[model samples]
Target: MTQYWYNVRTHQVEEDAMSDWTQLIGPYPTREEAEQALEKVKERNKSWDPNDTDGDGWADHD
Candidate 1:
């Protein structure tokens, strides 16, 4: 079975584990999920940011 990864730096899905941790987000099960990595991060950050009041103290100006 092939593995998939989302390249954080390039914003692209990789077919195998070819990138370093600083530039990647996943060993996702499918290419579709890998492609949505940025969306997933945004959704997670949205939920986490509100509850993370003690985190960084930056407000969401959006």
Candidate 2:
């Protein structure tokens, strides 16, 4: 019962943290497959800018 998590803010694949905010995107059997899916999501949302200092773009919410 492997699980995968994605950071929507950074659009990066994260190891299973199982937190309240980790956002479970998939429950794949293999880590490779989970990473692949994460890559696809990144591709679709290529404009993700996680470090916009001006606050006009994605903000680092923690």
The lDDT leader among the candidates is 1
Worst 10 residues of 1 by lDDT: 53-62
Candidate 2: C-alpha RMSD after superposition: 7.3
**Top TM-score hit:** 1
TM-scores for candidates 1 onward, in order: 0.73, 0.36
* lDDT of model number 2: 0.58
lDDT of 2 by residue, 1-62 (tens): 54666555565565664544645566556667666765566554545755544544444556
For model 1, the superposed segments whose C-alpha errors exceed 4 Å read 51-62
lDDT of 1: 0.80
Off by over 4 Å in 2: 7-17, 39-62
